[model samples]
Target: MYMNTLRKRSFQIYADHIRPYKGRVFLSWIFLLFAQIIGLVPPLLYKRFVNILSSGTSMDTDISMLVRIILLVVVVYIVMNICYRIAEYVVVHYVARIMADLNQTCFAYLHRHSHQFFSNNFAGALVKKVNRFVNSFRVLFDSFYWDLHGVVVRIIVATCVLAFLNIWLGVILFVWSILFIFVAFLFIKKKLVWDVQKADQDSVVTGVLADTIANETNVKFFVGSSREYARFETETRTQQYLQERSWMVNYWLNVAQGVLLLLVEFCMMYYAVQLWRQGLLTIGDFVLIQSYMFAIIAHVWDVSHIMRRLYEGFADAEEMAEIFETPHEIVDVKRATTLVVPRGEIVFDDVSFQYHATRTIIEQFNLTILPGQRVALVGHSGAGKSTIVKLLLRSHDVTAGKLMIDNQKISHVTLESLWQHVSYVPQDPILFHRTLMENIRYGKPDATDEEVMEAARLAHAHEFIESFPEKYDTYVGERGVKLSGGERQRVAIARAILKNSPILILDEATSSLDSESERLIQDALQNLMKKKTVIVVAHRLSTVMSMDRILVIEEGKIVEDGSHKQLLRKKNGFYKKLWNIQAGTFIM
Candidate 1:
């Protein structure tokens, strides 16, 4: 039942993509039918030529007629080839366009899924699915047009021609062809199960390899290369096993088909001989039966393989079809309006959130930040500080209650519009494998190069960036592994500074910097924060000392809210204790 559903889904995906080009597809099919019909004429002409030659006339006496027959055969073949080429050209041209569209469509749909969906699936697996989905379309279409469609047309034409010449011969070919296809389909049904399994295992192998490569540094640091190798070997071995099992099924199917074809060939030829001896069949009839028999047998043999290719294509496409069918976890509301954050005021009214229903992270959390206020959230690790920031960014929607920005509900606005007004610098910054200039300019795509350099100067990132031989053009390795932790953070800070959005979020953004770098960045941030509403999630007590207000959070709830000086005056308060520990001036 599941396989049946998947088959429908796979074809539907193909249909949707091809619907716009249906006219071209219909035209291609017309050309293909004409080509197949043209291909059948040569076999009939051969039978006629053989009968003429056997009419007891000397070669010299019938030389002109023989020459005419040969010339006609050659003309028929040339026309057949021309039609085949035209059909092929048309099919390939449209299939290429369709495949490219499918690739882009798959990528666009996959990206629309919420953050949670990405968290659950491996990136490598997702990439493989997209490639397979696109490539499988090509495989299935070619098989249908060149192999399956051609074979069907050939069989129908050959059967009709033979039945016209000899009814018994046509009946024998038609019934045997049906039996051959029916048996092949039964094998295909069983092989399809293995094909789907093999496809899934292939994805697993790819995911395992990607995961290992992505974490190559970790494996090297811990000297766990052997362990990773063993893990990868296990996955590959399973893949090999599934591949072999699938191939074995195909092998057995060919064996069964071969036996069927041999029996039919013997029965038909023996019957043809008996009719010839009884004067019921002409020598021409014998030649036609043999020629058509061989043609049908060859085409029938291809049916098993074509069925296998079709099902294999379906198996590959089904994986991505499932992803397309999954609804996006986050979507804009109907008639969603743009988020205009002129004041940058944020309000979290009676908000609550949980990754899972069994364990709540934040419960009934309520807070409001006035426009242009520099509010700091200080808490121990896992105290929901980052969660609060993510909520404000709408990375995950609130489980309950309303989160608004400048009087407009965040959920009521388009996600792109909401994100446009905010600049976020995460604790661990990830950079694309591109030039530093490109990475920095990501904050404001249309920013002038001069503006980018100025932003880098403000974030104190210009010194190291200029030292590289390539300067701003130096490529950052994957995830910016080429840069130190401090350098990546500075680049991230520079990006945020260049953005100059109405609201800024720094979740331990300065944590990775050295003391001197941090001091310089603090100075830069002060200027950047002049009129923007700033929310800082910091563990370091010294960073929040100058904030307008500091909220101490513990276990997902606000434990204290006051200025840094006021919080320090409370001798045993959570903020005060944190301050004392960081300052190394414990009161105990």
Candidate 2:
């Protein structure tokens, strides 16, 4: 029953992708069917030629007819081949288009999932699933069109032709073909479990390898290459074992199918010999029966293989189908509208959140920031400062209460619009493997080259960028690994500056830079902060001293709220103690 559901889902996915190209699919099917029908004519012609030669009379007349028959055979073969070529061309063309569409559709759906979903799944495994989905469609199309469809058509045509000649022989062939297919189907159903398990193990191996490669630097730094190799080897061995077991099942299935074919061949031939001895069959009839019997056996054998391939295709496609059926954790409301942020005011009205039921990250959180207010959230690690920023970004919906921007509930507005009005610079910035100019331009895709350069200059990123041989054209490598930590941060700052939205967020933005570089960036940040509502999440006390307000958070609550001097005046206050601890380090 579970397999039946998976099979239906697999077909549904394929149908949805091919629906737009139904005309092309139909045309291809027609050509293939025409070719299969044309293929049946050759054996009948051969039988006629054999019978004519066997009759012992009229040599001269017979010679001329034999020549004509040979020429006709050549013509038939040429036409049949032409039809086959055309059918193949049409199938290839449409399958290519369908595979491309399937790839894009899967990629788009995978990315639309919530951030938490991505965190739970491996990037490499997801990629493998998508590729398998597209490739399985191609496998299914080939198996059906070239093997299953062709075999079925040939068997039907051969049975009809034989039945016309002799009823008993036709019945024998048709009944045996049906039995062969039924047995093959049973074996295929049984093997599908192993095929799916193998595919899953293959994905696990791929995920482990990708993880190791992505974290190669960390592995090398810790001198754990051997440990990683041992882990990868274990996964590879499991994948290998599953693959071998699946192959053994296929071998056993082939042995069973061969036995069935042998039984049918012997029965048909023995019956033919008995009829010939009784003077009810001639040499021509014998040849025809022999020809059709072999043809039927060949097709039935192909049926066994085709069924195996079809089931394998289903197994591969089911993995991706499962992903497609999963509901998106975040989705816009039916009537959601664009967010309009006229004044950069943000409000958290009695909000609460939790990752899981047992532990609450933020509870009864309430805060209101006026337009153009510069607020800093000072907290120790896991104090919910980062979670607050994430909630504002709508990465996860709140468990209770409301988060609004500019008098509009965020959940009621489009995510794109909300994101468009806010700019964020994270503590650790990850850049694409692209040129510096392109990376900065990602902030505003339509921005001119001049505008990008100007933003880079404002972030104090221009000096180091110009030092590279390619200047702004240099590739940053994956996640900006080629650049220093400070360099990547500057590029991120440049991107945010280029965005120039009404609200700016800096999450320990200057943490990566040296004191000198930090001071220079601080100047640029001051210029950028004017007339903008800025929210900074900082651990360093010096960075928050100039802000209009400081909220010292502890255990998801605001323990102290005041300016630098007001918090210092309080005896043994949380903010004061934190400031004292960090002040000595800053001075040193």
Candidate 3:
């Protein structure tokens, strides 16, 4: 069943990937046919020259005729060569462009996929697949254009010419040609499939090596280098074994082909001698018969190799097509409405969600925040606080009920517009490998330097930022590894401050910071939250103690909601218990 699916998918890829270039492909075929015709003319014209030379005519009498025929052949050869070069150039250029376009389209689709897709596949495998798709076109053309059209067509044309020269020799050579094809196919077909399987196995091994190296830091930290090396060696040995087997099969098949060709050559030579002894055949006729016979036989041999290559091309194409044909699981609604910027009123009416069926996170919860209000969510780990933030951001839609912003259903709004008014700062902030100023500017691309500095000041990041050797020009290493944890957090706050969105979400934003840094960030947060609707997912109990309201979530449900003082007054409440634990007054 898997093999059948792969075969069908291979053909589908050819249809979809190649259909757009049909015009160029057709022109290439036409030029190839013209070149083949011209090539065959040389052999036929040579036979005529041999016949004329054997007539024992005086050279001076036939000089003009010979010269005219030679001149005609020369002219035809020159024209065919020029056309062939032009056609070959165009075909290769078209194929290159098509491969580039195909790679881009595949990558674009990949970019829009949800995070889940990436998590399940190896990064190296994905990269290698795209690279293989790009390289396969050249191989396909080399095996397809020359072998199929050039060699196969030449064989057919030569066969007809041979038959016309002498019926008996033609019949014998034709029988030999058929037998050779059958013999080659018997050995080559199975090996072609084996070769293709070997190639795929090689790609898988390469992908595994890449995936392991990419996460080498984790492996080394865990002291698993020896184990990883052993695993890799095992995979490599398996791939090498398959490759060696494929090579042996192909080598033996070629040997069979060579042996058959030698036998056919000997038999043809015997026929040529027999015909020469008979009165019915002339020297020129024997020459013509032998020339056409060998030409046909050579082309038949070339085509046998091509037939095997066709199978190999199909197999490689199957791997690439599988990736391309995967349907994107998420798609935007047709003509979805854009979410208009509101006064930051948000509502969650009986919302529920689950990343998977067995582990429900948010469940049957209802909440509302009036415009310009600051609301803080406090909870223990696995209390669905982060899930609530994700739902609001529409990273994953709710499984039940409705989420709304200013009474506008979030599902109706376009994802682009919905995110326009939202600004988020995560616990582990991500920073690009760029200068500090450029990184901050990414939050608001059109902001002036002064505007950026103002935002930095607001987030309490500007003082240290300007104190650096390069000031705002300082580079942040990959993932901001060059910056301290507190500094990176501040940088993230500054980015969100620059966005100046009416809606802001802080997801454990101060979890990694020292007490002083957290206090400073809280002060900056106080400033940023003014005149905005703020949803703070707080792990620190002290962070939410001064909020307008607090919601304590547990087991995917909001079990407590009120001002901080009110929740503290309820001694048995979830919020009270959490506060007691954080304050070291209770242990659970």
Candidate 4:
């Protein structure tokens, strides 16, 4: 059953990824087989040396023949060594190329997965899985070339030589090969269970370390440093225990394998001695039997060890397989075309959505914003406001109804083309660990340095950026940790400005700024918003009141929708209550 599973999975990988590597695969096998065949020559040559030495004692000219024989052996070994080196060079180069191809495919498949997949898994763990997947294929391929090809060649050569000497000796050799391999398999099966446990424990330790470091600032602020340390220590100890247990199992298997090798050697030699005593075999035949047994034992070790490692490697590959197994949750239809939204109009036709059996976040919700209009969505936390933004971006598809831009159904358009027309500034504004210039240029990779600076100036970021010694070239730390909250928002705004998409969504983009910074950024935003359809999500009433339309949503429904002054006419309206709290006075 285990072999069946391994074959099935290995075949699937070969069918999908390995088929593209035809040239490399053929070269690797040819080089490996040629090297192994040449390697078989030395053992047979050793028989000649043993036969000569045993008989040369009484012959007068034996000394001259011995020198000649030694020289011949040296030349053979030198040629074999050269071939082995060439073979190794080609195999290494091709192995790296194949692994690289698989690595790239894994990354492409993983990135295409839905937002929920990323939200559920840890970043560090996913990276580690891809790394392990590629690395395992490398190991498994090496084992196949060296152990499978090399060992099988060695065994076949030994068998043919033995049978040529005597059929009974060949029969004994073949039986010993089967018994030894069967014993190794039994022990390897036991060790594989431990290997799986160790792998699981390793992933846990890695996850804990990454989560702890990523949240280190929170740990310090909440005074939970000691608590986090204790948690990590417990996980580390468990991982260590699993590793020790796994190694112990492997050690016992090696001991059993050594015992089998000894038995095969003793029996083969004893039988050869009996044949010599009965005059059924010559002295050279006896020597040949001894040399072949040693060669077979060496190969047996390689084959068994490689098979064991292949099992472990396949186990690692299985984890990455799970990630690949999930089909893309949101995929464009056949013949999907690029969205052409010249008017920048958005409409949600009776849209509804829920997250995994949870209460509906938005039910039968409908809204429309005309071309180039400015709109604001105001609501409390968990009021499905962010969900609406994500739906617009097609990060998550609506559970019901259609979302359209210029009459093009969002699901029917290519994702890249759809996103190309929209510029989004997330609430926290994630930034890459790169230079300020590079981070801003990410929105428009081809944008010149001058253009980047122009966008920064419009977003009110150029003033602070110029203060740094490096100016635009300054490096922002991981996730923009080197920059302050307001500074990161400005960089994000500058990126959006560079993109200059037809539609813009700003989700609490200015919530982090102080009163003075807010006023300055609002002025910049006004310039960026011109002639573009803009959707703003804000908690502060100041940002919402200036919009042409305000939407008040609660309990998965739009409770009120109108201009700020018109909505405030109702004394008990949700929008009026929020406006009064922010300004500290009711508007007439």
Q: Give lDDT tens digits, candidate 2, residues 1-588.
A: 776777798898889888988888888788788888888887787777888898886999889888988999899889888888887888788889999989998988997898889888888999999998899999998898788888889889989988887788889999999998998888777777788998888889999999989899999999999999999999999888888887887788899888998899899889888988998777778777888788778888888788888888888898898887788987788899999988999999999999966789999999999999999999899999989998998889999999999899999998889899999999999999999999999999999999999999999999999999999999999889999999999999999999999999999999999888888888889988989999999998888888999998888889889888899999989888898888876633
RMSD to native, candidate 4 = 2.5
lDDT of 4 at 197: 75
- Scored by Cα lDDT, where does model 3 land? 0.80
Output the number of the lDDT-best candidate: 1
Model 3 / residue 6 / CA error / Å: 4.8
Q: Is candidate 1 or candidate 2 better by lDDT?
A: 1
- What's model 4's lDDT at 248? 84
Candidates arranged by lDDT, highest first: 1, 2, 4, 3
lDDT of each: 0.90, 0.89, 0.80, 0.84
Could you tell me every candidate's TM-score relative to the true structure?
0.96, 0.96, 0.83, 0.94
Query: Mind giving the per-residue lDDT tens digits that candidate 4 earns over 514-564?
Result: 777788888889999999999999888788777989998788788898998
TM-score for model 3? 0.83
Q: Count the backbone clashes (under 3 Å) in each candidate.
A: 0, 0, 0, 0
Cα RMSD, each candidate: 2.2, 1.7, 4.2, 2.5
The deviation in Å at residue 45 for candidate 4 is 2.0
lDDT: worst 10-residue window of model 3: 579-588
Query: Which portions of model 4 show Cα errors greater than 4 Å?
Result: 1-11, 56-61, 584-588
Candidate 4 or 2, higher lDDT: 2
